[model samples]
Target: MKTIKNENIFFLGVDIGSTTFKAVLLTPKGKVHHTVYTRTKPMPDAILSCSGECHKCGRCNLGAISKTIDDFLASAGIDRENVACTITTGSQIVDGLVDFIKYDAYVSEISAHVAGARHYYPDVKCILDVGGQDSKAILFDEDMQMWMSKMSGICAAGTGAFLDSVAAKLNVPVEDMDEKVNYDSKLQVSSICAVLSATSVNKFKNRYPLGDIIGAACRAQARTVMSGVGELFLDYKGPIVFQGGVASNNAVGYYLKEITNNEIIIPEFHQVMGALGAACLAAELYEKKKKKDASYEEKSVFKVGVDELQQIIESVGGTPLAKKLGGLKNKLFVHKSDNGLEKIGIPSIKQVKDAIGDVHLIREFTDIFDKVVLRKPATDKGYFKKSIAMRANITRRELFSRNRDVPMVWRNLFYPPEILNAFGARTVTLETYAAFRARNPKKLQQCFDRAASKGYSAETCSFLRVLEGDEKLPTPDFAVTTTEPCQQGERIFADLVRDYNLENKYYTLHTPYKLSEHSVEQLAGGLRESVKEMEKAFGYKLEHDKLAEACEFSNQAREYAMQANEIRFTSPPLIHGSDAILNALVFSPGWGKPEFVELQKTFRDELIERKKEVELYTNIEDTHRLVWLHLPPFYSKKLMNFIEVTNNAPIVYEEVNHVGWDILDVNDPYVSLAKRILTVGFLDPELRVKKIAASAAH
Candidate 1:
């Protein structure tokens, strides 16, 4: 440690890296006085609370980082007034810091790292640094002249964050890396891409021990670093200083030694070296200013023009990436049938809707569906696994490309899907379609914005907000709605009818709460009128023969549903919760349709066959079976997989599965149809609860 000419003059440096923030205090001689290092987000409670207020004033960035610095200073009992100058360095340095504390000196992170490392190891010829999200290497020749520098590109492989992510997946703490990794283990991971490496890690996790897997990950990270740096390491260099957060990992150090064949020196505060470097640079700047007696304006180069970019981002109320993605309008071409229900190529309107998230982070449902589900063989057991592929094909051929000579009906869950099926009409559930579009949280927010802009109440269900804003759905020739599933459905239906000017073609059923004979007839009359309305609207007569035939198909589907439930309740369940819910997604929306009935038969027969084979397996264990009430989340299929696969708690039954499956009376069609809707238990709140409880009891 060296003393400066001015003892009162102190230099403060802040390094705000992608994953963590570091603050350090140094005398004019660059001797460290205090230091702090921690993650950037999930900030310390005090800073987070201050950020809340700053966020209200559009100064959150300053409030958060400055508060963190303020707390760090307080911990060291240092006053800001004693600091003669302060400097900041990082990839995300912004002008907002000037407004926070009037500290405007900004140094590039690369310069800071070099200066910081040179302070401890003056003879060091090269620096290897791996931060949270990126990696870099700098080399110099014998004359101390900078020769080369290389950095990992946008891919975050070979970085501290990448290692942390893999550690989380393996259920191992990142700090335990030194003890967990077996250097002698021969396991290897070849992918240099962070996303791809994660997939590899997950694949090998079950096959390899934690120690060997982490060792492989470490080797892969080392290989990735060497690959990024290219042949620059081969140049003669010794005393290579390893800085940045990843320097803390001993396994990474071991692999680096093996690759570089050079002694790697890790400084005492390796994780906060960037901040120390910034402080050293600040010390130099302070000394120069004192000797020259010149006043250097405290300002950042980026601060001059950041206001324009800030305004642009604020105008859109999101990151630039979100705005750019939101502006994109990609069209998907499809072949259409006359009925308008039949179409090819456009499976769901969401497939064409612009993805809503960070450009790099967007995960399209279509990609996952095609690669994971659609690519699965048709013979795969379980309804969701096999039937989803089956249903997707059927939906494209029958619903999208089917004959549409009859009038089409757009309805909600409360309305029985069978009546529309019997009338030879195409039916689409508005809620289900909205659910699909709302899978991504950002997209859902966009939908909510659209409805809110039109003065729709935010208190309304999210699905309804999406339905009100989504205009891509085909215009139905007639709308059939029931009055029992709370007032929300009726309100949404009325709004849609009014918006589309379909007042003359709308039918409503005021279904009864009780299942008595009189209530049944009252409900039955309302349904019968809906059938007559369809006839008048389409200029076609109601055929009693077709109605009876469809009822028989409904009975067969119901029979299969009962058998499927029994199979699920077996000791070691052959069916997953998602499969059961998926069956309802297909059947509840398309009950009485021939394709749905056949799919049900396929599911039932496959389960019966699987049961026999599963019984032969001695290792199978019965998992906790939870009954999910109401509809399954339509946003992401991965969530279901997490619950079923990761948590191993499979839902055996969903309330929606009971729709139109309670043994309809084929002889008295209208009365039976009315009874099904009332008994499905979605009509009333208390009844739905009781139905769920009863199912759980069984």
Candidate 2:
């Protein structure tokens, strides 16, 4: 994937790491244009730009780097064509960028840093950097030759993580931490671990002054660096350069100077030295290459305009349907709002349904999902809004894949998608479809009107009404319903089957009134019969081994959910309410599928990382953590964000997330699954009340 390029003007370098995504814009002569050092979501969902104001939330995996480049160019007032060459250096490499953005060269981090440092100070002997996660000390010989580069290993004791955690514990803003140094205090912090250091500070806060505790923490961090790579740092010659994100801390820099007894030089753009280095290296390589290849002339690197690419795709196959799909191909399901946030803008239910016919559209939808819903910085208002839109986008694609490739079952939320998944079938739950339709209010009203046109009562559930009116979505070959959880869904499903004249394709799931052995056996019997019926309809056998495998994945997804839920307990909770709810929606119905499981795991891992960061550095106080008793409106994110920003009240947990089936025992598959359904809150009203009360008390 290439973009329009020019030989003159700017050279670009991007460095994406676990904590921050840094970019440097430089001229061919190595003069800087603009530089950005952005703190990422600590997850895969990369933030293109999220200052106190504008925010663009997107996936950080495939298109992360490319989007960063595009946004950077746009923000810097440089046309993509004017960028001479884009270079990349980072720990993680995204494949989506490789196809879209043509990089002039890729260099190692050490080499880039060396070139960047040398450009500024020709005879600098050593470089010490304390970044977000790791710390590095680069040693140079008399000729400024690279000798040894020692870095903090897996432990992040002396890095930004440690300082951030301690700062939060002391109720000091990270920017103000250095000013709180009390050098007169004789406090020694032995632990370099973030949590441990925070614990140590918290203990001393009562016995000592806040400034003194911060002083001890800073010294401890500086000492930890000495312990890790002090020998080489001390052995290196004079004029050492201290750079990286943590180098901004005057106290840490001052301590290093005292300990090393050397002149410490902090360069311009110290926080983003790695990115600057990468840009300098790119500029050097581009100049060298142009001199070596006399015939090389710069050309546009763009693969093609979106419209042109769509045309190419259409011309290869040349059909009316192909052409229509080609037109829709370049358009993303979500659109940007005036405030720079993304919104789900599928004009109507019919258009989204029609898009399913083109496999390209399905692929496009999934590709934009960013794989999993990302956890973004709380300060970015667009983060959660964009996440909601992304989830809604995926819901449509999943519906398409189910209708086209597998035996589609129109079911309700209470009915598990796992049963259908076992026989290689797909489910179109009422709640899921309704959630998608919520993006467009006019379409929602049309759906309601359609339900009334079909002779359904005005009092019918809104979810069922939307499903009844949706004529563009492919008709399901099979349908399943339950009697207890929601009577309206069963009644509407029955009416739908009758109206379509496909009563034989429908099945009624009977549930016992209470949680008893007989009830479990009854549910199991229903499941077994449903599986047999599905096998007959889909022309596939019910392989217990496969069912067991799906159950294991279901269990794994449950485990991940549990982990994420635990992290939600952190102050200024790391996981957003919308992200948690969307994650539950992903797994509640489709937990058995590998993709759903993978997404849950990704979301969970992101939450864990966020928890680690927030627990350490979040300085916000008086946070009011709220537990929502029921599901909020999926279409409107304003309510959630309003509560979060205006009132400092973040919805930490939703009751529905806790209602899903717990970890399953694949060994006794039927009984385990039977018991899982038996535990649903609606089946026992007492359990729902108790669970809700428990959440509130916490």
Candidate 1 at 628: error in angstroms? 1.4
The candidate maximizing TM-score is 1
Question: Which digits, one per residue and each the tens of the lDDT, describe model 1 over residues 198-240?
Answer: 8888889999888889999998888888787736677655767
Local accuracy by lDDT, each model: 0.70, 0.67
**Worst lDDT window (10 residues) for model 1?**
296-305
Clashes per prediction? 7, 7
Predicted candidate 2 versus true structure: per-residue lDDT over 659-698, tens digit per residue = 4555677776777777777776367888667766775665
**TM-score of the candidate numbered 1?**
0.45
lDDT of 1 at 167: 83
For all the candidates, what are their Cα RMSDs to the real structure?
A: 26.5, 21.6
